[model samples]
Target chain A: MPHITIESGKLTDEQKRTLVERLTAVSSEVMKIPPEFYSITIHEIDDASYGIGGKCIDLVKQEYMEKHS
Target chain B: MPHITIESGKLTDEQKRTLVERLTAVSSEVMKIPPEFYSITIHEIDDASYGIGGKCIDLVKQEYMEKHS
Candidate 1:
Protein backbone atom coordinates (compact mmCIF):
# COMPACT_ATOMS: atom_id res chain seq x y z
CA MET A 1 0.00 0.00 0.00
CA PRO A 2 1.82 2.99 -1.24
CA HIS A 3 0.52 6.51 -0.78
CA ILE A 4 1.94 8.67 -3.54
CA THR A 5 1.61 12.42 -3.47
CA ILE A 6 2.71 14.77 -6.22
CA GLU A 7 2.90 18.53 -5.79
CA SER A 8 3.55 20.67 -8.81
CA GLY A 9 2.05 23.28 -11.13
CA LYS A 10 -1.55 22.98 -12.12
CA LEU A 11 -2.57 20.28 -14.60
CA THR A 12 -5.70 19.41 -16.48
CA ASP A 13 -8.08 16.80 -15.12
CA GLU A 14 -7.05 14.42 -17.86
CA GLN A 15 -3.42 14.89 -17.01
CA LYS A 16 -4.14 14.28 -13.36
CA ARG A 17 -5.97 11.07 -14.13
CA THR A 18 -3.24 9.91 -16.46
CA LEU A 19 -0.60 10.64 -13.87
CA VAL A 20 -2.49 8.71 -11.23
CA GLU A 21 -2.86 5.75 -13.53
CA ARG A 22 0.78 5.70 -14.53
CA LEU A 23 2.02 6.13 -10.98
CA THR A 24 -0.25 3.38 -9.76
CA ALA A 25 0.89 1.03 -12.47
CA VAL A 26 4.56 1.67 -11.90
CA SER A 27 4.30 1.55 -8.15
CA SER A 28 2.36 -1.67 -8.27
CA GLU A 29 4.96 -3.22 -10.53
CA VAL A 30 7.87 -2.05 -8.43
CA MET A 31 6.36 -2.82 -5.04
CA LYS A 32 4.57 -6.05 -5.96
CA ILE A 33 1.22 -4.66 -4.91
CA PRO A 34 -2.00 -4.46 -6.81
CA PRO A 35 -2.72 -1.14 -8.47
CA GLU A 36 -5.98 -0.88 -6.60
CA PHE A 37 -4.08 -1.06 -3.33
CA TYR A 38 -2.25 2.16 -4.09
CA SER A 39 -3.41 5.64 -3.19
CA ILE A 40 -2.33 8.64 -5.22
CA THR A 41 -3.04 12.30 -4.57
CA ILE A 42 -2.09 15.22 -6.76
CA HIS A 43 -1.77 18.74 -5.43
CA GLU A 44 -1.90 21.52 -7.94
CA ILE A 45 0.26 24.40 -6.79
CA ASP A 46 0.90 27.88 -8.09
CA ASP A 47 4.33 28.59 -9.51
CA ALA A 48 4.83 31.21 -6.80
CA SER A 49 4.02 28.71 -4.09
CA TYR A 50 6.86 26.38 -5.01
CA GLY A 51 10.53 27.20 -4.64
CA ILE A 52 13.73 25.76 -5.96
CA GLY A 53 17.36 26.83 -5.95
CA GLY A 54 16.46 29.69 -3.60
CA LYS A 55 13.94 31.01 -6.12
CA CYS A 56 10.27 30.53 -6.67
CA ILE A 57 9.22 28.21 -9.50
CA ASP A 58 7.78 31.14 -11.42
CA LEU A 59 11.13 32.89 -11.49
CA VAL A 60 12.97 29.71 -12.33
CA LYS A 61 10.60 28.98 -15.19
CA GLN A 62 10.86 32.50 -16.47
CA GLU A 63 14.63 32.40 -16.50
CA TYR A 64 14.78 28.96 -18.00
CA MET A 65 12.27 29.72 -20.68
CA GLU A 66 14.07 32.92 -21.50
CA LYS A 67 17.35 31.10 -21.84
CA HIS A 68 15.96 28.16 -23.80
CA SER A 69 13.52 29.97 -26.02
CA MET B 1 15.33 23.06 -4.72
CA PRO B 2 13.75 20.14 -2.98
CA HIS B 3 10.02 19.85 -3.26
CA ILE B 4 8.71 17.82 -0.36
CA THR B 5 5.22 16.46 -0.49
CA ILE B 6 3.72 14.66 2.51
CA GLU B 7 0.53 12.63 2.27
CA SER B 8 -0.98 11.12 5.37
CA GLY B 9 -3.81 11.28 7.83
CA LYS B 10 -5.28 14.64 8.73
CA LEU B 11 -3.22 16.92 10.92
CA THR B 12 -3.92 20.18 12.68
CA ASP B 13 -2.73 23.51 11.34
CA GLU B 14 -0.19 23.71 14.14
CA GLN B 15 1.06 20.26 13.36
CA LYS B 16 1.35 21.14 9.70
CA ARG B 17 3.32 24.26 10.54
CA THR B 18 5.61 22.37 12.87
CA LEU B 19 6.11 19.65 10.29
CA VAL B 20 7.03 22.16 7.61
CA GLU B 21 9.45 23.95 9.92
CA ARG B 22 11.10 20.77 11.11
CA LEU B 23 11.34 19.27 7.64
CA THR B 24 12.76 22.47 6.27
CA ALA B 25 15.33 22.65 9.04
CA VAL B 26 16.47 19.06 8.72
CA SER B 27 16.39 19.04 4.93
CA SER B 28 18.39 22.22 4.81
CA GLU B 29 20.93 20.77 7.21
CA VAL B 30 21.35 17.61 5.18
CA MET B 31 21.00 19.00 1.69
CA LYS B 32 23.14 22.10 2.30
CA ILE B 33 20.39 24.35 1.02
CA PRO B 34 18.83 27.39 2.55
CA PRO B 35 15.57 26.74 4.37
CA GLU B 36 13.82 29.26 2.18
CA PHE B 37 14.80 27.27 -0.88
CA TYR B 38 12.81 24.28 0.23
CA SER B 39 9.19 23.77 -0.69
CA ILE B 40 6.98 21.71 1.55
CA THR B 41 3.39 20.74 0.89
CA ILE B 42 1.30 18.71 3.27
CA HIS B 43 -1.86 16.94 2.21
CA GLU B 44 -4.28 16.01 4.94
CA ILE B 45 -6.04 12.81 3.98
CA ASP B 46 -8.82 10.86 5.49
CA ASP B 47 -8.04 7.30 6.54
CA ALA B 48 -10.55 6.02 4.06
CA SER B 49 -8.75 7.71 1.22
CA TYR B 50 -5.45 6.00 1.88
CA GLY B 51 -4.56 2.35 1.49
CA ILE B 52 -1.79 0.01 2.59
CA GLY B 53 -1.27 -3.71 2.37
CA GLY B 54 -4.46 -4.01 0.37
CA LYS B 55 -6.43 -2.40 3.19
CA CYS B 56 -7.74 1.10 3.52
CA ILE B 57 -6.10 3.23 6.23
CA ASP B 58 -9.32 3.42 8.17
CA LEU B 59 -9.45 -0.34 8.47
CA VAL B 60 -5.79 -0.53 9.26
CA LYS B 61 -6.09 2.06 12.00
CA GLN B 62 -9.14 0.47 13.51
CA GLU B 63 -7.51 -2.93 13.67
CA TYR B 64 -4.22 -1.62 14.97
CA MET B 65 -5.86 0.54 17.60
CA GLU B 66 -8.03 -2.32 18.70
CA LYS B 67 -5.05 -4.57 19.02
CA HIS B 68 -2.91 -2.07 20.84
CA SER B 69 -5.59 -0.77 23.13
Candidate 2:
Protein backbone atom coordinates (compact mmCIF):
# COMPACT_ATOMS: atom_id res chain seq x y z
CA MET A 1 0.00 0.00 0.00
CA PRO A 2 1.27 3.44 -0.88
CA HIS A 3 0.57 6.07 1.73
CA ILE A 4 0.74 9.73 0.87
CA THR A 5 1.91 12.32 3.34
CA ILE A 6 1.77 16.10 2.98
CA GLU A 7 4.01 18.11 5.26
CA SER A 8 3.43 21.80 5.07
CA GLY A 9 1.63 24.85 6.53
CA LYS A 10 -1.74 24.59 8.23
CA LEU A 11 -4.70 23.90 5.95
CA THR A 12 -8.41 24.54 6.27
CA ASP A 13 -10.90 21.72 6.52
CA GLU A 14 -11.89 22.28 2.90
CA GLN A 15 -8.28 22.17 1.81
CA LYS A 16 -7.65 18.94 3.61
CA ARG A 17 -10.75 17.32 2.16
CA THR A 18 -9.89 18.35 -1.36
CA LEU A 19 -6.33 17.17 -0.93
CA VAL A 20 -7.45 13.72 0.16
CA GLU A 21 -9.99 13.36 -2.62
CA ARG A 22 -7.78 14.69 -5.38
CA LEU A 23 -4.68 12.89 -4.28
CA THR A 24 -6.45 9.58 -4.04
CA ALA A 25 -8.21 10.06 -7.36
CA VAL A 26 -5.13 11.08 -9.31
CA SER A 27 -2.93 8.43 -7.75
CA SER A 28 -5.47 5.72 -8.37
CA GLU A 29 -5.78 6.74 -11.98
CA VAL A 30 -2.03 6.47 -12.44
CA MET A 31 -1.28 3.35 -10.38
CA LYS A 32 -4.38 1.38 -11.40
CA ILE A 33 -5.24 0.86 -7.74
CA PRO A 34 -8.52 1.42 -6.00
CA PRO A 35 -8.92 4.80 -4.25
CA GLU A 36 -9.89 3.09 -1.02
CA PHE A 37 -6.46 1.44 -0.82
CA TYR A 38 -4.69 4.78 -0.60
CA SER A 39 -4.23 6.55 2.70
CA ILE A 40 -3.33 10.23 2.87
CA THR A 41 -2.29 12.22 5.91
CA ILE A 42 -1.32 15.84 6.27
CA HIS A 43 1.23 17.15 8.72
CA GLU A 44 0.62 20.82 9.29
CA ILE A 45 3.18 22.96 11.04
CA ASP A 46 3.01 26.52 12.30
CA ASP A 47 5.25 28.98 10.51
CA ALA A 48 7.16 29.57 13.73
CA SER A 49 8.02 25.88 13.96
CA TYR A 50 8.88 25.39 10.28
CA GLY A 51 11.98 26.60 8.50
CA ILE A 52 13.12 27.36 5.00
CA GLY A 53 16.71 28.08 4.01
CA GLY A 54 17.69 27.84 7.67
CA LYS A 55 15.27 30.70 8.50
CA CYS A 56 12.04 30.29 10.37
CA ILE A 57 9.02 30.21 8.07
CA ASP A 58 7.33 32.98 10.04
CA LEU A 59 10.37 35.18 9.53
CA VAL A 60 10.43 34.34 5.87
CA LYS A 61 6.79 35.19 5.52
CA GLN A 62 7.29 38.48 7.33
CA GLU A 63 10.09 39.42 4.97
CA TYR A 64 8.01 38.52 1.95
CA MET A 65 5.09 40.52 3.25
CA GLU A 66 7.32 43.52 3.92
CA LYS A 67 8.76 43.32 0.44
CA HIS A 68 5.34 43.10 -1.16
CA SER A 69 3.52 45.58 1.06
CA MET B 1 14.79 12.43 -0.73
CA PRO B 2 13.77 9.95 1.95
CA HIS B 3 11.50 11.96 4.13
CA ILE B 4 9.80 10.17 7.00
CA THR B 5 6.26 10.85 8.10
CA ILE B 6 4.66 9.70 11.34
CA GLU B 7 0.88 9.76 11.59
CA SER B 8 -0.53 8.96 15.01
CA GLY B 9 -2.15 10.31 18.17
CA LYS B 10 -1.25 13.68 19.61
CA LEU B 11 2.25 13.69 21.07
CA THR B 12 3.76 15.88 23.73
CA ASP B 13 6.39 18.39 22.63
CA GLU B 14 9.03 16.37 24.41
CA GLN B 15 7.83 13.24 22.66
CA LYS B 16 8.05 14.95 19.32
CA ARG B 17 11.59 16.10 19.98
CA THR B 18 12.70 12.68 21.10
CA LEU B 19 11.10 11.03 18.05
CA VAL B 20 12.83 13.33 15.64
CA GLU B 21 16.15 12.83 17.34
CA ARG B 22 15.96 9.09 17.71
CA LEU B 23 14.47 8.40 14.32
CA THR B 24 17.03 10.48 12.53
CA ALA B 25 19.88 8.99 14.53
CA VAL B 26 18.89 5.36 13.99
CA SER B 27 17.97 5.75 10.34
CA SER B 28 21.11 7.67 9.58
CA GLU B 29 23.17 4.98 11.20
CA VAL B 30 21.60 2.35 9.01
CA MET B 31 21.22 4.24 5.72
CA LYS B 32 24.62 5.92 5.74
CA ILE B 33 22.99 9.30 5.48
CA PRO B 34 23.80 12.31 7.58
CA PRO B 35 21.35 12.93 10.41
CA GLU B 36 20.81 16.48 9.17
CA PHE B 37 19.86 15.16 5.75
CA TYR B 38 16.97 13.13 7.10
CA SER B 39 13.63 14.88 7.41
CA ILE B 40 10.96 13.75 9.85
CA THR B 41 7.45 15.11 10.21
CA ILE B 42 4.73 13.99 12.59
CA HIS B 43 1.04 14.33 11.83
CA GLU B 44 -0.70 14.36 15.16
CA ILE B 45 -4.39 13.55 14.98
CA ASP B 46 -7.14 13.63 17.58
CA ASP B 47 -8.65 10.25 18.41
CA ALA B 48 -11.97 11.33 16.93
CA SER B 49 -10.37 11.97 13.54
CA TYR B 50 -8.35 8.76 13.47
CA GLY B 51 -9.83 5.36 12.72
CA ILE B 52 -8.64 1.82 13.32
CA GLY B 53 -10.32 -1.42 12.24
CA GLY B 54 -13.25 0.60 10.83
CA LYS B 55 -13.91 2.16 14.27
CA CYS B 56 -12.90 5.54 15.64
CA ILE B 57 -9.81 5.42 17.85
CA ASP B 58 -11.59 7.29 20.60
CA LEU B 59 -14.37 4.70 20.66
CA VAL B 60 -11.88 1.87 20.69
CA LYS B 61 -9.96 3.49 23.54
CA GLN B 62 -13.17 3.99 25.49
CA GLU B 63 -14.06 0.34 25.06
CA TYR B 64 -10.61 -0.72 26.18
CA MET B 65 -10.79 1.47 29.26
CA GLU B 66 -14.17 0.08 30.14
CA LYS B 67 -12.92 -3.46 29.78
CA HIS B 68 -9.86 -2.79 31.92
CA SER B 69 -11.60 -0.77 34.59
Instruction: Give a tens-digit lDDT track for model 1, residues B19-69.
Output: 666777888999888887788665567889888889998998899999999
Report clash pairs, candidate 2. Answer: none
> How many clashes show up in model 2?
0
Give the least accurate 10-residue stretch of model 2 chain B, judged by summed lDDT: B12-21
C-alpha RMSD of candidate 2: 6.8
Highest-scoring model, DockQ? 1
TM-score of each: 0.51, 0.55
List residue ranges in candidate 2 displaced over 4 A. Answer: A1-6, A10-43, A47-69
True contacts kept of each: 0.21, 0.02
Per-residue CA lDDT of candidate 1, range A1-36, in tens? 679877778899999989998989988998899888
Give fnat (model 1). 0.21
Q: B15, model 1: CA deviation in Å?
A: 21
TM-score of chain B of each: 0.84, 0.87
After superposing candidate 1, which stretches have Cα over 4 Å from the reference?
A: A62-69, B1-69
lDDT, candidate 2, A12-46, per-residue tens: 99999998999999999999999889998887886
